[model samples]
Structure formats: C-alpha cells, structure tokens
Target: MPATRPPTPLRTPRRRPKKSRSRRPRPPRPPPPPPSESPAVDPENCPVATDAEGGVDNAILLPDDPWTLNASSLTLKDASYKGIVEVRTASGATKRVLKYVISGGTDIGDLHQTVQDKRSGATHHVQAAKGSLSTITDGDTVMYTESISGNLLGLIPITFDPEHPPPLDIPLIYFTKVTVKQAGQFGGTLHVPGLRQYITT
Candidate 1:
C-alpha cells in the first residue's frame, strides 16, 4: 500500500468532445412526393372499361354483359402470366383481336384460353387442367346472371389498379375446377377468353 505514488498516472480522462447532435442537415427527404399523377383508376371514362390494369399488372375483365365467375374453378399457382381478354367491342363494332407469340411459359398448370369472334370470323379455344379444374356453376358470390340471350347484363365492375404494387400476388390464381377445352366443348368458351396476364414476381 505504500506504492500510492504510482496512482498519479491514472489521470488520462480528457476525451469530452463528443456532443455532435446538431443534425439540422437532414432535410433532403422531400423527393418522394413526385410519383403521383392521380389516375391509378377510374379515368378510362367508361365505354365499357372494366379495370385492374396498372402498367404491368393487368386484369381488366370488362363485363358489360357476360361476366359470371362464381368460382367454379380458377387456380393459377404463381409464376404469373395469365390470359383472357376481349377488347374492341363497345360500339367499336366487335373487334376481339388478341395475338400472342408466347415464346415462353404457359403450360404449367393449364389455362391458355383464347376466344375471338371478330364479327363472325369465328375463333375459339379453351384450357384449364394441370391440377385443379371446375369453373363455376349456379351462384353464391352475390348471385346475378341471366343473359344467355337478348339484352344481356353482367360483370362490368372491377376497377382495381391503384398503382398495383403489392406482395407478389401477381395474378396468381393457382387453380380452377376443370373443363374448358372447346371446339367439341368442355367448358364452352367462357365468353371467348380475354385474360392476358404477365406476372413475374
């Protein structure tokens, strides 16, 4: 205990210059307000412009007269890229023109659907079957469908594209009951197919 004189070397505590909290330079965060042009939906004006088409997430089922899908069967399993569309028929005088080169993807779970009737030129085909397949019947999603003839009226109300950016649901339906192989008939051409999809999440 007589060596107390050696304790004088412990006075090296002079590091008090760390109070740098004057962070007033953080105002550069305002660049995020420039990405909204306002029309993520409801601006097609409606001449029969159903919805769900924000850039690359399309799903416009345009049903002004024939849109009955109470869920009999429609499963898509996630790889994205669905198909079924029929535009050009609202006073434009029936012009269902859809062409696809495919080039890749689309025989995974089955449902490559297509339908065309460009003023009776006639063209139809159907698909659905790789796992599940049934495709609606009767009623239950609210119930409303009765126009196999005359003055039709159904579907026509889907508008879902608020900028369409979510967690990879990318048109991933994954499965449907079964039966849709036209010509000789299996599903009878669900209004002549018009559901072109492209999901790659």
Candidate 2:
C-alpha cells in the first residue's frame, strides 16, 4: 500500500476571538438661539382710532406685565372709561349695567371721575385733592380714587388653577386716548401687557 501512511493525525480547529463593540463618542451639540424681543409699547406703533360709540380711542402695550395697573402709563385728558358694573338693587337682586362711563378730568395726576345717569339724565362727578389712580382691578374696579393706599391694582387673580378655571366674572374697562407717559420715573420701565384700550361696539 502506497503507504496509507500512518492514520491521518487528528487536527484541532483554531477558534477565532470575538470582537468587542466599543461605541464612539458623539460630537457636542451647539447652543440654542436667544429669545426674540417684543415690540416696544409706543403710541407711534399703535395708532389712534375711533370706536362705534363715536369716541376716540388709542392704546399701547406692556410686553411684561399683564395685570398690575401701571399708574404712570396712562395719560388721560378729556378721556372717559366705560365698563360693566355689578350692583345690588334695593330688591336684593344683582344687576349688571353697561355704559358706566367714568370721565372728565383736566389734570394728569388728579383724581376726577364723572358718571352720568341714563334714565334721570343727571351727572355726578368726584375729585380728590391728593390722590392718584392706584390700580385697575380685574373686576374693573378703579381703586385709589378715594383711598391712596392699597395693594398694586391687581388686574386679575394672581394665583389660580389653570386646570380648573376660577369662578371670576372679570370685567373689562375700555379706555379712550391712553397714551404712554414719558419714560422716566415708573414710566416705560413698568411694563403691563394688559390692554390699554379696547373698542367695544
């Protein structure tokens, strides 16, 4: 036999080593862009207009403050304010009246408000020697006319649960010719985003 040589020697197969999966480090992300600035609350930006009631109206915006009435922002001249008023009659029933115009005043830092009765055609006005408009409450209540001291005019309930709407019959005051006062002491610095004027039909 061509020499079936010795029986083939047993050969052991070599095992290959497994490669480890090493993750590569990711590149760092870039910084975000800065926030955009809001438009200035200037009358030049907000032009004057006339409302349906034949009253001239003007307004400006406070980009920061939505509530707290900024006393220094308003420059009311021969202007008036109209809003909804809730009153209790002698019959012990609540009633909401409209066209409750509070107007008439010659001075800027003076307390003067005039109201006219529709039915009786009579007018009533009040003026305080040493006082300024404190605030415009959410209820459309103008405080500081009679009393000079009080919390900053709260435009709305400061704290409320958004999930559950608060039981508030918040009223709105439509002002006429509300111009921005000079920017100095408590002027342009005090920002109130609330509506300076609203033209109602």
Candidate 3:
C-alpha cells in the first residue's frame, strides 16, 4: 500500500517572467533674463571734449543765449549739421568769430595763420565780421549773429564733405533775416547776404 502512494504523478514547476525598463519624462527649463546695460553708447550722445587745435568742441561755439538759429528746410540745406551751429535768434544779437575757414569763402579771414603770426610786418591779418556766414565746411566754426527779434527759432550747421561734390539741385544754404524796407509802405524780405558757394575739393 505504501509503494502505491509513492507512485503519484510528478508535478511541473512554473517560473515568473522578467519585466522591461522604461524612461521617465523630464521637466522643462525656464528662459534667461535680459541684460541690464546697453551694448554700446552712441557717439553723438556722448560728445567728447578735446583740447587739440581745430577740434569740433573748440571750433563750434555754443552760444549761452537761449535763442537758436532757424534751420527749417526753408532755412537749412541739409539736416546733417542742423545742431552744429548755435546762435540767438533775437533782434541785434552780436556774434563774434569763433574759428576760421582755410579754403571755403567766409566773411572771416584766415584766423589760424593770423593767430600764429606775431610780426606786424606780416601781410596776412584776420578781421572779425558782424554777421555769420551761412555755409560752414568740415573745419569751420563761425560766430552767428541774430538780427531779428524772435523766439528760439532754430539751429543749423551745414558741412561739405571733401570727397563728394556739391549738389546741383539745391543751394548750399540761404540765411534769411527779416528787414523793413523804406518803401511807400513797410515791406519784409528774406536777406541772405552771406550765401557762400559750394567749395569743391
């Protein structure tokens, strides 16, 4: 009877399968903040003061008076030198010679040579003018005189590049001063007494 119980059928063993690994998603990153300072400063905004001769600061005289030159398109030749020349736009405002022009035709004579020459025998002499010239070239800074009584009208500076020729279409500069003519009745006219021709290189 014991041999008969041992004769039971043999049982088969079951095994569990291995699981596959998976990657998890990562969180997104935030953007960086903008820079505080500017990349570069403009040269016009930061005008440099120089002591060298013929320097822009030394040549250009900024008038202390609140008035300015009238430089509308009607008055100015171009917008490039609009703010270069400073003048008072009041009646009978006297402007002195600030610099001299070597090549261009200006009311002011050669000032650089005159300033350097101490000998009275020298024929070259510099004389000051009451009215300012309309056209100013690359190295010229002349005084501006205001003849008409008006508010701060405008300030204009006209420069000619040595490399380029004068514009045939438009006049270089035309300065207008309101004056009363002694006709039967008082009349007004724009007197551009100091219009200079375009000086070619």
List TM-scores for all candidates, in order.
0.20, 0.19, 0.22
Whole-model lDDT per candidate: 0.30, 0.31, 0.29
lDDT of 3: 0.29
- Candidate 2 has a TM-score of 0.19
Which regions of candidate 1 are displaced past 4 Å? Answer: 1-64, 77-86, 93-132, 135-172, 175-201
lDDT (Cα, tens digit) per residue for candidate 2, span 20-122 = 8899989888888888998779865554354432232212211221112223223323323333333333333433322222233222333333444555665
State the lDDT at 50 in candidate 3: 47
Q: Which of the two candidates, 1 or 2, achieves a greater TM-score against the reference?
A: 1
Q: Pairs clashing in candidate 2? A: 65-193
* Tens-digit per-residue lDDT, 1-201, candidate 1: 455554445567788888877766665655565676865666555345444332211132332332222223333222232233334322332222211112112222334444455556554544444343333322211111121111111222221111321223343332223222211111111321333433221
Positional deviation of residue 9's Cα in model 3 after best superposition, in angstroms: 1.5
- Which of the numbered candidates is closest to the native, going by highest TM-score? 3
Collision count for each candidate, in order: 28, 1, 2
Sort every candidate by lDDT, greatest first.
2, 1, 3
RMSD (CA, Å), each prediction: 21.9, 22.1, 16.4
Judge candidate 3 at residue 47 and give its lDDT.
Answer: 44
Backbone clash pairs for candidate 3 read 69-154, 81-157
Q: What would the per-residue lDDT of candidate 3 be over residues 41-102, giving only the tens digit for each residue?
A: 77765644543322232233333432223332223223222222222223323232112112
